[model samples]
Target: MISALAHGYGEEAINIFNNMVRSSMKPYRITLVVVLNACSHSGLVQEGVRYFESMTRDHGIVRNQEHYACLIDLMGRAGCFDRLIKQLEKMPCELDGRLWNAILGVCRIHGNIELGRKAAEQLMELEPQSSAAYVLLSSIYAALVFKKKKKKKYICCSWKVGMGREGETTYGGDWRDR
Candidate 1:
């Protein structure tokens, strides 16, 4: 299920989840995790929200921090900053680095430096040792700088003929500092 979702087979993942439900396979927190992730990736924001909002009501699954994090990622990717802000404020669980980092990631995507700084501050306060927020902040700045300087961002693309990709590829590859 997770493999299908991770590989962008969102419909397949949904079908699996439905089959699980029909078969009475008790879904744990992890099941919804992948479901929400698939929805987020597939731009099924409304569906994801339905599942999240109905977790406890329908499946008897209580939303934990991770669940909230997935919702945040979903809204962030969808560029619903206004709704995302309201959801963040109303989040039942305590704010954590993961949540803040997710916000920072979306801010980076939306070119929202102000919100990105705020997320960075919050994440730094929560997990000072973690470098994820710092790296994301750096990326935000680099993007802003690139726009200001109008630098031709040379996307590094390696091509071994008959290997894989044919055109210039970009490296959004390095998500982890490690």
Candidate 2:
């Protein structure tokens, strides 16, 4: 199922999941993880939320760190920053360094500098010796610098021909960074 999902076969995996349910085969943690990942990959935000709710409501699978991480990642990727922050606040267990890091990474990607800084500060408070936390903060600074600089950016692509016309080609280095 995971292999299928990884290969972009989300609909097929969903069909298999439904078949498993029809056969009365209970889904375990691993199955939930795979489906959650598929939900993220396919941008099935609503389905991901439903499945997360069902994990505790129907299956009685206690939500753990991994589950929360996946949920946060899905919500963050969907640009549901408010909900993700609220969920983080409501976590019963003290969030591990990894969870904070994931949130910080998303914040950085979305250019939410304030939120990223807050997450970084929280991470530092939680794990003072974590090199990852430092790196994430540094990345936020680097992104800000790049945004301010507005340097020219170029993309290069190379093509190779193995047929009768043996040749090399390059294209697309014209776009200016802004």
The prediction achieving the highest lDDT against the true structure is: 1
lDDT of 2 by residue, 1-178 (tens): 6546633776567678768878988888878877776776677788888888898787778878887877877788788899998998888877887788888877777767888888898899998988777787787777677778885547777867676676656676643566
Query: What pairs collide in candidate 1?
Result: none
Candidate 1 per-residue C-alpha lDDT over 15-59 given as tens digits, one digit per residue, 9 for 90 to 100? 888898889888888889889988888888998899898889978
- TM-score, candidate 2, is 0.79
Predicted structure 2: lDDT: 0.78
Per-prediction count of colliding residue pairs?
A: 0, 0
Q: Which ten residues in a row are the worst by lDDT in model 2?
A: 2-11
lDDT of 1 at 143: 80
lDDT of 1: 0.83
| TM-score, predicted candidate 1 vs. hidden true structure | 0.84
